[model samples]
Target: MQKKSIQNKDSLKRFVDKGINEKELSPFDPPDAYNPLNIETIPYEKMHPFLKELIDEHKNFAEVLSKFETALMNWKNNNWIFNDEIDIGLKQFFNFFDEKVPLHNQKEEKKLFPLLHKKLIEIGEHNSVDSSITGINLMEDEHLKVAQAVAIVFNFLELGSQLPDKRSREITFELAYEQGMAIIETMKLHIFREENILFPQAMKLLSKEKLDDFN
Candidate 1:
C-alpha cells in the first residue's frame, strides 16, 4: 500500500510538472451563459438592505481571494517555499471561508432561497419537469462544490507539508493550487450569478413584505 501510494504521488508530480492540458482545465472555465440576468445596474443605496449586506460580504471575499491568488502564485514561483506574507494570505483565505462562508450561505439558504424557490415556481420560471430544478438549485449546488474544493485544497496542502519527499510535497501542493483556483473561480461566478440573476429575480418576484423579512 505504501509503495503504491508513493508511486501514485510520483506520477501526479510528473503530470503537474508537465502542466495540465487545456482540455482538463476547461471544466473549471466559466460557461458561456454566465452573464448577469439583469441589464440595469442597481445602485447600492437602492438595493435591499439584505442584498447590500450580502454584496458587502462578497466584496470583502473578493479582496481576500485576490490576495490568496497572489500568495499561491508566489508560493508556486518560489518552489513551494512558505513565507510570512504567503502564510498570512493562506490563513486569511481559510479563516474567511471557515468563519464567513457558512453563515453567508445560511442567510441565503435559510432566509432567501426558500422564498425565492416558491416565487420562481409561482411565476413559472422553474423547470417544468422538476419543480426542484431552478436557479436556486444551481446556486445551492455550487455552494456544495465550493465547500468541497476548499476541503480538497486544505487537505492536500496539509498532507503535502508533512510529506518527507520533495516530489510528494510538490505534487500535493500543485494539486492544492489547482483546487484553490477552482475555489476562486467558482466563487466569482457564484457571486456573479447571485448578484445578477438570483438577487434581481428575488427583488422582482418577491413582494416588498417578503423581501423585508430578509432584513
Candidate 2:
C-alpha cells in the first residue's frame, strides 16, 4: 500500500511539472482545470466556493494596494524626480485605485451589505447587522478619504510634469509620501475590518439560501 502511494505521489508531481522545472513554472500555470460551472444548476453546497472566489479577488486588491504603497515609499525616500514612463505608470495606478476600486465598494455597500444584513436579521441576530453596519459605514468613509489622497498624488504628478517649478523636489516628494501613507493606512484598516469582522460574520450569518441568492 505504501509503495502504491509513493507511485501515486510521483505521478502527481510529474503531472504538475509536465516538463518544466518547478522553479520555471509561473504562478498562473497549471491553470485551474477548467470545470466551467454549470451556473444554472449550481446547488447551495457549491455557494461557498463562489463566495471564496469573490473574497480572493478582494484580497488581490489589497496586494495591489500594498505594491503601490511600496513604490510610493521608494519614490519619497529618494527624490521626487521620475522618468516620464514611471510617471505615467504611477498615474495609471492612481486612476485604477481611485476610479475602479470605488465601483467595487459600491457593489459591497449596495448589494452585498444589504443582503448580508437581511440574512442576519432573519436569523434573529440583530447584533451582527449592527456591527456590519458600523464597519460598512466606516469603510465607506475611509474609501472617500483615500480617494481624495489619490487625487492629491495625481495633481502633484500632473503639475510636476508640466511646470517642474512650483515646488522643490523635496517638497514634492514629501507630499507624495504623506498622501501615499494616508492611502495605505486607510486601506490597511479597511481590509483588516473586512477580513477580521465583516466577512466571517457574514459567512456565519448567511444561510444556504442567502448564499445561493448572492451567487
Candidate 3:
C-alpha cells in the first residue's frame, strides 16, 4: 500500500509538471459545458437584504481577485521572481479566502441553499435522473472546487519558495500560477451564476416569508 501511494504521488507530480511545461493550463473557457441560465440579474438595490449583503461581499472579493491576478502576472513576467508586492497580494488573497469565504458559503449552504433546493424541486428545475441535482448542487460543487484550488495554489507557492533548486521552484510556481488563474475564473463565474441565476430563482420561487427568514 505504501509503495502504491508513493507511485500515486509520483504520477501526480509528473502530471502537474507536464501540465505546466507542455501546454497552457490557465485559460478556463469551457465550450458550452456550462450554459448560464437565461435569467436576468436582479438589480442590487432591489435584492433581498441577505442577497444584497452577499453581493457586497462579492464586490470586495472581486477587488482582491483583481489584485491577485496582477501580482501573479508580475511574478510570471519576472521569471518567477518573488517580490514584496507579490507577497502582499498573495497574503491579501489568502487572508480574504480564509476569513470570508467560509462564512459566506455557510450562509448559502446552510441558510439559503437548502430552501432553494426544495423550491427548485417543486418547480421541476432539478435533473430528471436525480432530484438532488439542482442549481444549488452545482453552486455547492463549485464552492468545494474553489476551496481546493486555493489550497493547491497556496501550497505550491509556499513549496516553490522553499525549494532548493531553481528548476523545481519554477515548476511549482508555474503550477501555482495555473491553479491561481483557475481560482479567479471559477470564482467570477460562480458569482455570476449566483447573482443572475440562483439568487434570482430564489427570489422568484421562494415566498416573501421564506426570503425574510434569511434576515
Top candidate (TM-score):
3
Per-model lDDT: 0.74, 0.54, 0.75
Clash count (model 1, backbone only): 0
TM-scores, all candidates, are 0.82, 0.62, 0.83
> Candidate 2 residues 121-215, lDDT tens each?
46443333243333344445666767777888777666555664546646665666676666665566456545545566666667667666755
TM-score of decoy 3: 0.83
Which portions of model 3 miss their true places by more than 4 Å? Answer: 1-37
Worst 10 residues of 1 by lDDT: 10-19
Counted clashes in each candidate structure: 0, 0, 0
TM-score of 1: 0.82
Candidate of highest lDDT: 3
- Runs of candidate 2 exceeding 4 Å displacement: 1-47, 84-89, 117-133, 163-169
Residue lDDT tens for model 1, 81-188: 999999999999999999998999999999999988888667655544566555677778788878988888899988999999999899899888877866776677
Candidate 2 residue pairs in backbone clash: none
Clashing pairs in 3: none
Q: Ten consecutive residues with minimal summed lDDT in candidate 3?
A: 9-18
